[model samples]
Target: MIALCTPSVWAQIKNSEHPITGYAPVNGLKMYYEIHGAGKPLILLHGSHATAATTFGGILPELKKHYKVIAVEMQGHGHTADINRPISCSAMAEDVSAFIKFLKLEKVDILGYSMGSGVALNLAVRHPDQVGKMVLLSPVYKATGIQPAYWPMLPQITPEVFKGSPVKLAYDSVAPNPKNWPVLVDKLKTLYSQNFDWDQKKIGAIKSPVMVIVGDADMVKPEHAVELFRLFGGGQFGDLQGLPNSELAVLPSTGHVGLLFRTDWLLAMIQPFLNKQTN
Candidate 1:
């Protein structure tokens, strides 16, 4: 299932309404989203550094096969309203949860990538009934298998200080909130330096069906995917350890950003996963 999705490659979302749709979503930002198909609602959350447009690209088309996909771009990214305040995983998660409820959706299949996965976790944990099924792709280190609430507070940095990091330079080129600049850079660095311990006790609280996917080379690493997959099904050291019905998909030679453009393989696997649920 490992295939190349070059940057030049593109996918046109046919049947998409003009300019997509925007709503006065939670967090007081105009969240951007587009709806397609005519079935169970599936919420797609993009990575922090990317917009929904760039992350899903081609997969949205195929997902429409059996799902009414609602791909949403979070605040400070893509077509969503911009904000200058500090950004945190909990802040974004609250915004996402509010949007889902504001829309009056009975339940939704949720898929989150990278930083967005943190938001998804918060949603599933706090509003478990709203989530029918969940998928986390290379979730941030803390959100995947750590105690999301136990995140260690760190010193926030400015973009100038973040510029010293190589990863920051590569991220700033298409930065969604250029206004936040150094604030964002410093925040990400701090977030990465210390991973919240999402232990089995915390994960045991999640009762929804879950699937964890990862590119073998993902920045979060394969071991993380295994831990998440195990947690979703109950971990070896936990009460529900060895719980069934969870799966982990590993795509070799793929990383965080690379997986975003690699829609072919993503659709091939994700389509079947969601299909099994709705059917």
Candidate 2:
């Protein structure tokens, strides 16, 4: 299970709120998003069944300081309304790409956690020209990247399983139609239950640099994280040859959910990588 962090930072972010919020008409659904601060665009995608607030609340304050943070609420999540279409990473990536174009952003950095990470990866692979860099937190690129034990649990995540939980409560608070919670849950269940094994050739062909972050105890196995890093031209012994453009960080004592809560730790690692000048 993902660990929850202290509520102070979350409260602060919610109370202050994003200065700008709007819905971008993309691929039939009006995708909701919030804009904070201003600089190089950095699109943030939340995990399954989560709002941008739920996933990035703790770190948004710091992240916005350096980026024109665009925190997106994917279809059927948060303020975004439900649609008739099925939810999948590839489809969501397309929506995001269109949203970026709608905003006239030439190229932007992308960051995502869990399910959102899948979408971010797809975005980089499918629309390489639209992406500058990528950060994948607690992500699994392929079906086998996830632990075997976790596969069986996907089908078990029904609406009833999330009743009264923070995820449900968050949805109820911000969803355009609060009663559609069950429908959102059902769609997420279907999305998560299906197996996703992206083409390795496509992943290796991504031109943008990437940063892969995972908890040592995350749902995604550590070795899989290393393998993904390697795919991105990272994980090399850089004693003589300089480090690769791609990077990896396995936070100690962190879990899937807890990984997002470590704002200070994440900032320290993420800032330097983002600030570095690309050769």
Candidate 3:
């Protein structure tokens, strides 16, 4: 059955507005990304589990109409998908920074979803000069501490871990496991997820406009998202945009998956915000 995506979403992909492309980040990591329109450059970062295709699939077309959109597939996921992936989220953030430099692009727009948001936040926090505008979709901020549930993903050298194809199996399970929250949490812990601290102070250090968003029914604790918003220094536009210009959009009855996939709802929440950026 064909999915019912918002007309704008479908139009972006259909009208050949956004063209899928790839980039070889450091270590020959062939990262996948897509580009659309020709205005201010915008980079799209997808969340965990699936590839960029899954997260940015709907917003591509619509966004293409406004700014230059670039969707990237982080290592071990999507086009960069591979097992025994050499790095964690922090490393992935570094890879993104390298990609931007290799492209010879000084500054651009960024929209991050779920895990992608974390990666984007890391870049903004660490490499401020690389990004102009930032959007944190269901952002994950470890300001207080790591979630107990993510303990499994913490680094652990298990003899049996590298056995067969641990990486592929890990990616394969992202979908089915998402059905049950607890089970998913357990799986993440087992994956040896790293607990990297996100310094809220660094967020304030970011010299760019920022937007934070989350669905009221989002599964990932909303507080985490709020922490990210507040980290931006929330003054107004141009000042980090932690909480002020960093408007939080929460759709009632929308779960994490719904927020990421709901074309109309996502457009309603993000379109205006994005429009205001670099417009």
Candidate 4:
């Protein structure tokens, strides 16, 4: 049985406790993934500059009890080595799509955080039939979805800034080439610095049920989440018009880092949504 742990224990769990781990050859990169428990497939995608263990380690134990949790490390992050290509959310989403097809999973639930949430959104929009239910943590579809103040700092991000942080520590422990840390940072800097945004019409056309969760103080503005909710046909008077296929949740007084630790509250809300049938 996997015991619940904090992100600090990521290296320990990733090294010794992974139940099933393998590499999938997709999009010219050997993507690494870990599988735990048994039930309907639920894919877990980590944020940028993080590994699956760091992003979802706290809730993996609880989630594994109910679903076959498949945690994946995307391009240039964690165990997956970077290719000689630029990093983009759209391309990463396609890599995940190819990974799903590689596994022969017809449909699966997906939960993504931060950068991973953008990949999840791209997957849903690009391959709607392959996704069942989706949960986006601190998601942002457009460049403007993020707070304006954070923009000025994006291009200035460097590997040296996170020298002793958990993100850097986690990467050094598990990444194939720790020396490539600077390269990874550069790729991510370029990816986020772009003025890229998804088309609204495509977002509104997704058929899969969605759950949007955000911290009240998250980098992603609460108003942006509500706007995304409306695109999914939300913002209705639920008392009179019934609930929408999608949900929007704002955690009180939470920040991006602290949002993942509230596993108790997260599972309480997530279980029902994943189990509920959507029309």
- Candidate RMSDs in Å, in order, are 6.0, 2.0, 7.4, 3.0
Worst 10 residues of 2 by lDDT: 1-10
TM-score for each prediction?
0.76, 0.94, 0.72, 0.94
Model 4 — which ten-residue stretch has the worst lDDT?
1-10
Model 4, residue 244: C-alpha shift (Å): 1.3
lDDT of 3 by residue, 96-161 (tens): 898888778899778887777778878887788898777777776662433454454444633244
Q: Which stretches of candidate 2 lie over 4 Å from their true place?
A: 1-18
C-alpha root-mean-square deviation, candidate 4:
3.0
lDDT, candidate 4, at 82:
95
For 110-196, candidate 4 gives per-residue lDDT tens digits of 999988989999999999889998999999888888888788888778878887677787788889999999999888887765476
Model 3 lDDT on a 0 to 1 scale: 0.62
Q: How far is 63's C-alpha from truth in model 1 (Å)?
A: 0.8
Superior candidate under lDDT, 1 versus 3? 1
lDDT of 4 at 151: 82
lDDT (Cα atoms) of all candidates against the true structure:
0.65, 0.84, 0.62, 0.87
